[model samples]
Target: MTKILISIVGPTAIGKTALSIKLAQHFNTEIISADSRQFFKEMTVGTAVPSTEELNTTKHHFIQHISIKDNYSVGDFERDAISKIESIHKNNDIAIMVGGSGLYVKAVTKGLDHFPDVDKHIRTELNKRLINEGIETLQKQLKSLDFKAYQSIAIDNPQRIIRALEVCIGSGQPYSSFLTKTEKTRPFKVVTIGLSAVRSIIYDRINQRVDIMVNEGLIEEAKELLPNKHLNALNTVGYKELFNYFEGEWTLDFAISEIKKNTRRFAKRQLTWFKKDETIQWFDYTTDINNIINYLEKQS
Candidate 1:
């Protein structure tokens, strides 16, 4: 029998975790999480990690397996996840991988595009520029250099903007130029399952989930990690908003609202990224599990 990796991907609060757990249980195999936020042990409530009950239902890897202090990159996760999947494939003919992180899922199923070694000072200069001149400067620069990247990437994301700009400046070429549209051969087949919902439903779900996270002591969690807010791991939606609240930049109520708004934007960006991939088998968020199972069975 051929080994297969079932990748469940979608936006935030779209039920990927529940579906992944169910699939893993049915296949009698372990699961690998591709959610970057959930990798940190220090960030639980904000990252919406699988509950103790859900995690106990099936074995999982890569959830809270690292600390916030670690500089874990997408490259690091790609290598580690590939290793875990290979190991899992040894025992079962099928394994499950799930997350809203489209890039990480692409890395495992396809492969990360290789870019040239950029000058170290390029990133430093970009960060300095971002601080002194603001993100708009970098955005305009990226727009001038790589219009495709400007259109496709999350323009509001400073990290992504700086990354594209540095590559464009360092290599004297568009950042998009480095993207090799080629898939790396793997020993096993990969079946991508994407969950989707109407925009209003997605927004409603995100709002509700944010409320739940706040009720679950997300503020307290952020308070504990406030000293390390400078870390890239904590520079995300929920934690960052609360950090601002702690800094007197916003009220707790306003901060919670920002979390909801930012999460909705994050979900929008996730859909934009995943929608570009034509290979994924998409289903409504409320699709029956048996239908998905039958499709996978037929494909396998």
Candidate 2:
């Protein structure tokens, strides 16, 4: 029998988790998460991991399965997710993959692009530059070197900027040059489902979600992870903003506002990335779950 992987994608706080749980329940199968932010066990509240009830309701893999200290990459996740998917297919014909991280989702469905290994010293030097000269210095360098990659990556996130710069400097080629236009083939059939809403609605949802995260003790969680703020995992929006607040760099109110603003920007980037793929079927965030299930069942 042919297996089907239902991929749920959308902006943050747009109900991807709720939809994934419903679809998983309908198929009586498990879910594989592609959200890189939620991989760290210490960063739960800000990551918006599924509620305990939801986790109990349906099995989910790769949610907070690693620590901030662990070194995990998109390539590593691609291999592990494929293994898990194949294992799940041994007993079930349908499995669901869900997240707002477009790159991770693409990694699993379409194999990662091959890049030449960089000397560790290149990344080390870039990190030192990031701290000494500030991210703006390196950002300008990346823009000068690879404008395409610079435009696509998260400019505010130092980790992403540094990663791209390292590859560009190390390989002596544009980072985008390494992004293979070809997609790898997967054994199972894939049906990508995207959830979206009007820009105003998406922004409102993000603001509200950030408020909830704050109420749920996002500050304390971030404070706990403050010492590890230098870690690549802590280079995310919510925690970074909070870290700024803790360091007296930004007022708490300002930090909270920054979190919402940065999150909104992140959502816009996500929609832009996923919209480029014509294969995805998009629906309003409030679209009925039954309609999606019917579509998947037809695919099966």
Angstrom error of the Cα, residue 280, model 1: value is 1.3
On the 0 to 100 scale, the lDDT of residue 222 in model 1 is: 95
Which candidate's TM-score is highest? 2
- Candidate 2: how large is its RMSD? 1.0
Residue pairs with colliding backbones in model 1 are none
lDDT of 2 by residue, 110-229 (tens): 888888899999988988887678889999999999999999887877877888988998889999998877889899999999999999999999999999999999999999999998
Write the residue-wise lDDT of candidate 1 on 30-93 in tens digits: 9999998899999999999999999999999999999988878788999999999999988999
lDDT of 2 at 211: 97
Q: What is the TM-score of each candidate against the true structure?
A: 0.95, 0.98
lDDT of 1 at 114: 90
